[model samples]
Target: SQTIHQWPATLVQPVGSPLSLECTVEGTSNPNLYWYRQAAGRGLQLLFYSVGIGQISSEVPQNLSASRPQDRQFILSSKKLLLSDSGFYLCAWSPLGGRQPQHFGDGTRLSIL
Candidate 1:
């Protein structure tokens, strides 16, 4: 069975500070990994996606970046967080080339102060 883990379930940071969030998957290999952010009352917006190791696609250019350092580890980072950066950050995974429903870990809810 495949499972995903993401942490610091919630965070409060001052504006202009740096941010780093991590996600990892177990029981799967070379799965498609995605980072999404959901603002208050808005739909999930794709931030980045990785098809394989060292391969990432950015869906938006904002105050955020993503990286895949291992087969199952994905990271989201920001150099200087903005108040607009505060939201629900989610990590999801799907089987390679299959239509399996994407599974999400408990999201990181960030609030900028």
Candidate 2:
């Protein structure tokens, strides 16, 4: 089983500021890493996914970008933050074949100040 860990449980940033959120998976190799965001009552939106190092897939055209630095380490970053970007950010990991359930981290609650 893989355990995902996300940092900075909560964050408050001013508009136009930069943001970086990280997620790491332990106990797994070559896992699929994912970044997701959830609004107040909306469903989870997939932001990015990585199948291997240096390979990233974006689901939307926003001010955010994701990177897979290591095989089990994934990062989410933005050069400029926006008010609409405030939400609960999450990181998840699953097996490569898409047959297993994903394990999510505690998540980070981001608020635009």
Candidate 1 on 1-113: residue-level lDDT in tens?
88999998999999999999999999999999999999989999999999999999999989899999999999999999999999999999999974778999999999999
Alpha-carbon error at 62 in model 2, in Å? 0.4
Report every candidate's CA lDDT.
0.95, 0.94
Question: What value of lDDT does candidate 2 attain over all alpha carbons?
Answer: 0.94
What TM-score does prediction 1 earn? 0.96
Query: For all candidates, what are the clash counts?
Result: 0, 0
Pairs of residues at least 3 apart in sequence or in different chains that clash in candidate 2 = none
In model 2, the runs with Cα more than 4 Å from the true position are none
* lDDT, candidate 2, 56-97, per-residue tens: 999999999999989999999999999999999999999997
